[model samples]
Target: MRADLDIEGGVVVGIDGSDASLHALFLASEEAGRRDCLLHVVRAWTLRTAPRPPEVPPSTVPSVAEFHDWIVLRTRALVEETLPAPEDRARVRLHLPRSQAVGALLTAAETAELLVVGHRGRGSRLMLGSVAAICVRRAGCPVLVTRPHHRRAAGRRATAGG
Candidate 1:
């Protein structure tokens, strides 16, 4: 753990601007509140499209910055609004990055006491989203895959193997 980063009793959660992820955020916050730990919420984004030669090859991609900014803003608001009054914003930290969501989350989870994520955010239960599955399999800490409203979406095939 970085000396500047505080991970003692920290709970890291991934927020992907989806209801399921938001639920994960809420659950993480509640857990943190109970343990009096800090909650770290990270939202990740990637460039929608890479610049082509004819497109003047912009010096930098603005969309990346904008997406990260949006995630930070929205995650901060959701965290603040969902938590109880006693849970102060000072105890919550939001991170926005322009990398893969699962990788960013796993990195954050390295020093965290616990990691919380949704089972299938915006994806079918038959197939956990790549990010969620990756975190569950690779996170340094135990992962709680929350599914407060998980239901079998229509047309999802049943699998024989677990």
Candidate 2:
């Protein structure tokens, strides 16, 4: 693990602006609060790997600096708003690495107590995104992949309990 990647036994989570990733952030924050630990959110990006609009021209694509700024601005707000309590938000520490998601997440979780991620990211339509799949298989710490509750199942459970 790189010295900079050490989170001092915090909870690490990867966020990609996806609903699943947002839930993962919430779960990580809640878990971190429960454990009295920091919540480290990873937003990995690089020009080589950053997603771009299909219709955008190559020359008009956003540069790495632009991309970084966008992610920081957008994701910071998302993270801040997702956690319900101020104290929970205070415990969050963002990790913006200029690398691939899988590598960034694995390294960030090296010294963390747990790692959380979405089941699927924006880049993929499959049930499991490659990054989450690799992290689950290779992260040094245990990985928790978040999945949103199914509405029908939730309704059934709610009515059953009543």
Candidate 3:
């Protein structure tokens, strides 16, 4: 964590560069704007290494730092593209921590006013993603799991007709 960055009482959102995560980010940003609070954007990444044959040299694989940098860069690009408004970008503080997604989000949410995350992130097939589920269970503050727009619309239609 940076010396100047304060996660406490902020609106914390977990971002993974997925469309669902982006939706969560937008919603979190709007909530933060409404509350006049800071928006903390967090993205966690882990490096995976595959076993190499004895004949293979170690130089072929990218270093952990390289992977971390790539993730950070990609995340920043996604944020920039998704949040084009200068005011919206101004209120956000991005954190690209090289750790497990769940742990990072839980830590970020320790003192947050609210923890927001996508209902289902990339590669998630269930109704809720693992990170969002864990955050909802373990976060000290309120948690908002953002559903996909289509699903939300469908749900609204069902409720309105019922």
Clash pairs detected, candidate 1: none
Error of 3 at 133 (Å): 1.1
Q: Predictions ranked by lDDT, top down?
A: 2, 3, 1
When 1 and 3 are scored with TM-score, the better candidate is 3
Native-to-model Cα distance after best TM-score fit, residue 70 in candidate 2, in Å: 1.6
TM-score of 2: 0.81
> Ten consecutive residues with minimal summed lDDT in candidate 1?
153-162
lDDT per prediction? Answer: 0.68, 0.79, 0.77
Worst 10 residues of 2 by lDDT: 153-162
| Tens digit of per-residue lDDT, candidate 2, span 111-154 | 88999999998767888889899999999999888775658534
Across 1-162, the per-residue lDDT of candidate 1 in tens digits comes to 121233445998887767778778777877888888888877666564212223334685455546555556666677766564554566887766667676677788788889998777554554567778888889889898877555541112123111
Tens-digit lDDT track of model 3 for 11-124: 999888777898888778889999999899988766642112333357677666667667666777777876777898899888877667888888887789999999998878
**Residue 143 miss distance in model 3 (angstroms):** 0.2
| Per-model TM-score versus the true fold | 0.71, 0.81, 0.81
Candidates 1 and 3 compared: the better one by lDDT is: 3
TM-score of 1: 0.71
Q: Model 2: runs farther than 4 Å from truth?
A: 1-6, 48-61, 151-162
